[model samples]
Target chain A: MGLRVLAVDDEADFIETLVKRFTYRRIPVTAAANGPEALARLDREDFDVVILDMRMPGMDGLTVLQEIKKRHPLVEVIILTGHASVEAGMQGMSLGAYDYVLKPVDFGELLEKANKAYERKKLNESRDHS
Target chain B: MIQDEFGRLRLKLIAITLAFSFVPLLSLGLGLYAKFYDTYTDKIYGNLRNLVDNKKVTIDMFLSERVAQLSNLALTESYQDLAGDAYLERIFGVLQLHSKSFLDLQVIDQNGLCVSYVGPYQLKGIDYSHEDWFRTVMAKGIHVSDVFMGFRKYPHFNIAISRREGEKTWVLRAAIDSDIFDTLVRTVQLGKSGDAFLLNAQHVLQTKPRFGHDMFDTVPFPDIPRFSGTRVDEITVNGQRSLYAMTWLNLKDWLLVIKDDPAEEFLPLYRARWLLILLLSGGALLIVGGAIFIANGTVRQLIQSDREKATLDASLTQSSKMAALGKLAAGVAHEVNNPLAIIMEKAGWMRDLLTEEDIKASPNFQEFEDAVTKIEFHVRRAKDVTHRLLGFARRMEPTQENLDVNLLLEQTRSFLENEANFRGITFVRNYQSDLPHIESDASQLQQVFLNILDNAIDAIDKNGTITITTHTVPESGEVDIAIADTGKGIPKETLEKIFDPFFTTKKVGEGTGLGLTISYSIIGKLGGRIKVQSDEGQGTTFHISLPIAV
Candidate 1:
């Protein structure tokens, strides 16, 4: 239970690579190749943080983030976007996302931001439980 | 020195006008002179012919009347009676009473001897046989002899009448003095330097000529006409140009020649020619001078307009090139940005992963790190270059609003005032007070001001000054900003390219060169214009104009 996370993106290889890097960093990671798949997986699991890509084929990251926030209010999301999509990425952050970073993702910085998001989510959960 | 376009135009105009106006007028003057002189000379010749005809009639009448008186005497007197001197003396007395033209009257018998003589010489019994006059009088009824020295040894002309009295012929001959004919012919009026003289068939002058020709001298002619009416010809006499009119007398083998100097005769024509020449020359001067003046004014205007158009064309070409380049740069920068960012992060990730203790201890780990570092460095450089390109080609819509242009300039100037102080440069701001506010984007105008101010500082390099001035037009609702610099100015070759993207005088990595390009496009979007003036080794000035209330 070091860090529970779900990574959503349209690129299969990028998700796979993130999964491998997160596993080596001693964090528990799950991946979905699209926004709908990530939402369906989020319904079945209890992840503390979600890494959302703003661009996807079936469902965009912002759409997926909104669904996640409604069903699992305690979960925190971090946005991944390209330089051109920075404005939309900021919009996502205002919609209760933890933060945003530009691609190609630096896994180390992504891990740091993901861990912070997990801690914030756990802190809110603990408060609710107490 | 050679003439310029305008100078050549003026010269050609004057030349053409003078040719068109002067040539025909001068020729008409000359033509009129020739025609008038010809008509005048013809009229003068006609008048002289009438005068000579009247004089010939008088001379012929005088000779015939004397011959008639002698003929009456021969008929009245008998041959036997006329042999005596007394009856002849009575007839001579009657002839003298009528006209004193006869010098002597003589009576010759059939033997060709003067039987009676009533004159100054005593020749009462002179032998007349084998004399030519006695034979000419014996054959013809009457004979008028040429002037000769008679028995009196005086030059005289004689008219002889031969009569038959029952086959016995007697001749009555009267000798006339020649002095009476000279006075009649000399009385004809001619012009100054005009001479009227008589000539025989041999071209001898019978009467005294007032010119250089002496009496009895042979005068030359191209071809002597025979009994023709008065005809005039131009001939040179004594090396002077003269008109000669000749007429033949019917009564004798004589010609009347009149010599008139045309120059003297047509003095009024000479006077008219000089007046015409003077007037033509004056008109030519006045017209040519006016044409040249008009041409100079028109050509000056044309040259001025041509120069302005050329300057405008050059600037237009430069602006179009800049606009085209800006569009291309924007597209390229946008398309390449995503890929460059990807490469940068990937390389940065690789560098981050090599931090394990055992891998760091490897001999080639430093080389691996160096390669990754170089990749990241180059990627960052590429990012900067693309960012500048994107900035130059920015097509983002500007937010327009009412902004104080003076305040905007002050805020931009403050940004560079510290840098100016550090570089020992003086910044002079000449802002107009109470300038009319403009409807424009504040951020964009600030950016343009900052861009121009920063460039001015960089141009000065060290120890220089820049002056900024602003003015607002009340009528046109426009604002003008002039930024002058006392720095090493841009060359004329580079001035046209200064507003284009990536054209800079700064060293590598010092400037992106998109400052002015972005400022230009931004001003364009705001419906404004920028112009630059530069002198090498002196300084540069940039003028910007904007609508105050757009």
Candidate 2:
């Protein structure tokens, strides 16, 4: 099946654009305004990949990443942030993020990172089934 | 203002040194000189008193002996015998045999008639009762007269004695030779201008002086106490300062005076005083000179340290400014990036839409695509600026990695090789073959090296050489890299601010001006130093020294 993606950010317009870009690519996608909404959506639906913004109004990306990893170890996350802090990037990676990307990144690069994250999730799922 | 401060400090130091050194020196010198003067004056006066006392005794004895001889003659001889000229002559000869002081002898009756005379003159029958000695002897029994011109027309003084026999008086008189008496009084050994003489009660000279006046001439003497013993006084005669000692003779109203110039007598003391003055002045000059030298040296050190402190303060201010600006730039870039991301995403979405059939079919499709392309291009440029701002703000501890400085420099220079080649700039690498590795972040060091290389290439502009040299400083445990360029060098006025953030010589949009600022900060983080030296017309050289990994 094609990749099912969940994008979470406080910026509504940025989320909307990400959703449109995923839709135009013929991939199924979902959007959340913040960490709580994104976590609630993850509980209701199975997503292959999650694109998370590190800075948010409530429940920042690292906390959300930890909760998601504990609840659903099979799913993979891609951290996206406007603040280019290497320390935060390293923290996110050690917290089981698949990759960290700075904002204003090309859509093609983001799509590729999401596809790779989805592939890793599928591989993890298959291993669990076996 | 700082120069004035230092000058004042130096002057104060010199003043304190002089006061501390000279006050004691001058007071001691003056006190010693005064003591020496008093002691010397007392000693000179003491010597003069002793000399005058000795001479007075000799003169008194000589006069008494002459009177006793005359008195013996009047008492022992008969009047008939003394009146015989031949017998008186025989008595004079016997007196002369014992002493040469007597000049002549004569016999006179109580009426002042000269009955007998012997030697040096013919006054055998002169009128009687007219001579002062004859009249004085008749009443007093014995008389001594002062020096006078007698019938012989010569200066002489007589001693007379009278004897009464059966209501008749016979007088015996002897004339004392003035030359022999004068010689006895004037014999003294004093330095160069010393004189000795006898002065009678009337201030008349009884004898000739060594320097001035004749016998019986009036003389000026300083007022002194009329005591029997010797007294010393200082007097100025003929504008010459002299020390004179006087004593009254026991035989007569004569004053024995001995005088000498004190200038000659106190020559050694005066010389010592001059030597003391010379030493004081010489020592004062030495102290002043030494004080000035020491003050100058101390002030120079103070000035140098102050200058160093000022330079350090300025650099600290510049560093803090750079840090604050970096934070602001990072904050601004973070805030601006969100909007930049939205714009970029929207433009990408539009470009994606332009690929659809309906949008592609529109007549304005190319313009829409061109506009979207421009939006994406500018957005990318904005993203780049934001990324650099974040990098500048990221003052994280550098990761330590063993790095060969020469290899790192070569790699950095390679990035600008194409550009430098395009501008006809030549790269000359002088790498030490055995340069040691340093402990620093490789990528950060590369960034600093790249920045310097880029600046060097830019400075060279076109058709010039950029020389890169690397050497190890074994003593400092550091490695030095020198990048020199043969381009038009940085102007002196602009060189000082070259490392300041946003300070650039390039035109707008060509340079962000953060290259040197970032390089400086990076090198500092890596525990290295960066310095630049430039001559406006000659060229520029940037020297970077990095600590070698232990």
Candidate 3:
């Protein structure tokens, strides 16, 4: 019924702020500092949407996105990048990411995209059940 | 420095050319001239020797004939017949009728008493018993005397012969005219300043020399080697170099000498030599001139090509520098964006906290809200810079799409149409109707066109035209777009750096200077070229050529 989110980034302050903002909106959110930790978190708990930073210290966002798509086929991924690379965005989209967002994005816009991604996950899960 | 290099190159070329051409020319010319000189000298000597030999034979024959005539007269005439002066006079008259060289004739008895005399002066009883001619004839029976003035008061020579008659001996002597004889010996037709004469054993002129010597005048003669036939020699006479041929006459102890100034004798050879020298020198001059001319032309071309290469190298270096800086800017922007994002998020979270009622009632809430707002605003500005840096880096591959350049240009022009009108600038579009579509990124090409059009609009002070023309090159399968502006054109120094990132001629804060750089990169990625031509006051034109899609 509510949006459950995972905010993954190597930048602790950025990730902490993102988590606090999500918490302020009353969304259930978790945090991971790296791609491996994000994948570990995804494996333990169910998340509606994953806001994954494209560039991370270990196991970049695209790899995590692939692993998530392979394991949890119903989970939506939104790629966040500081660098605006259309090619990476295209690759992330091809890898079944729900959306790609550049850094310094407004929190409201990020929330809107995450909500849309969660809706898509619900739609995907409903279609699977049917 | 470049001029000095090229000058050295030109000189080296000229030197090599002259060495190759002039050396052979001089050697060949000198070789031919030496060979010709040798042959000509041999010919001249041979000719002079032949001439002298012929003249010697002639003089010898004349003397022998005179001796033979006198001996005939002595042998045929009896003592009684020649004893009278009248009979000897008649015989001398007949001898003169045959050859007028005889000046006088006389009949002398064994005592050397002159018995009869005929012609010339009065010498009817001149005693000649002790004279050289008389005594020599008494012993030798025939004698020819050297030129002497015996009772004749002038230069003369006598030939005498003895006749034996019944235990008595008589001598007949005759004087030969020296003037007539000199004329006979001097009949050589050598060149001007040539002299022919007869020199006796005493080095006295027996015949008058054609130049200054008189008959019997003592003359200095060169010591000639004894030879049987005619000999030719080079000698200096009167301080002038001359070639002479000498031969001994058969009948007399006289040397036949034919002397000539070699400068006159070998005039033709000298002339030919001069002509050869002239030709060789003229040819050398021509070769030198041609070598210099060709060297200059080749060096000019080399200098021109080197200048073009230097320009190309500089531009390539600039391009690589821009590319490296782009990468560096992208990395820096990307790095800064993380912190910026954290700031933006933290400020936004604070703003979110301010929305709660408990924090909104605090006394510092407005200040905190204002401070957070300022932080967000500055973050936005930082984000704008990072975005521009990422754009400049151009790490993303362009999305390929079918693009109609004319339509794209029209759309791009529309973006600046309002600004152009406000600035009193008119857009003149000259689109080729049948232009082919090209394979390129539509958005990227639009960006390039918009940038150029925007620049064109900004360039104008007021009241100017921006002309955009497009045409397809059938051969290159490319479409050429030319954008020209009648504005205060870019200065030459600024035009070359226009495509360099952050190099701007605009005043501070007026431009980011990345429009042309981004445009250049975009066009380069699309397999196109951008070129600019500008006249400082006249205008500027930007030409962009894009490859057509297959």
Interface RMSD of each: 4.2, 0.9, 0.9
TM-score of each: 0.60, 0.70, 0.69
Report the number of the highest-DockQ candidate. 3
Q: Which regions in candidate 2 have their CA more than 4 angstroms from the true location?
A: A24-28, A57-59, A85-87, B1-8, B53-102, B105-119, B124-174, B179-195, B199-257, B261-264, B274-297, B300-304, B307-315, B355-357, B395-550
Residues B1-550 of candidate 2: C-alpha lDDT, one tens digit per residue:
6578899999999999999999999899989998988998888888888888888888888888888888777778888997888888888899999888788988888788889999888878887687665777788888887787767688778888788988898888888877766787667887788888888778888787877788888887665556968788788876777888889999787888998887888889989988998999899999999999999999989876875565455446655875787789889999999999899889988988999999899999999999999999999999999998888777433468787888888888888889988999999999999987778888777777888888877777889999999998889988999999997899989998788666679999999767787778778877889999999878999999988864
Cα error, residue B417 of model 3, in Å, equals: 15
Clashes by residue pair, model 1: B112-B128
**Model 2 residue B499 CA deviation in Å:** 17
* Candidate number with greatest lDDT: 3
What's the alpha carbon RMSD for model 1? Answer: 9.6
Candidate 1 per-residue C-alpha lDDT over A11-123 given as tens digits, one digit per residue, 9 for 90 to 100: 66567667766766677899998877888898898788888888777787888889988988888999987543445667998898999976545556787898788888889
Superposed by TM-score, candidate 1 places the C-alpha of residue B217 at a distance from the truth, in angstroms, of 4.3
Give the Cα lDDT of each candidate: 0.78, 0.85, 0.86
- Candidate 1 residue lDDT tens string, B104-147: 88988889888999988888888887988789889987887655
Candidate 3 clash total? 0
Count the clashes in each prediction. 1, 3, 0
Model 1: DockQ vs. true structure: 0.17
Among all candidates shown, the one with the greatest TM-score: 2
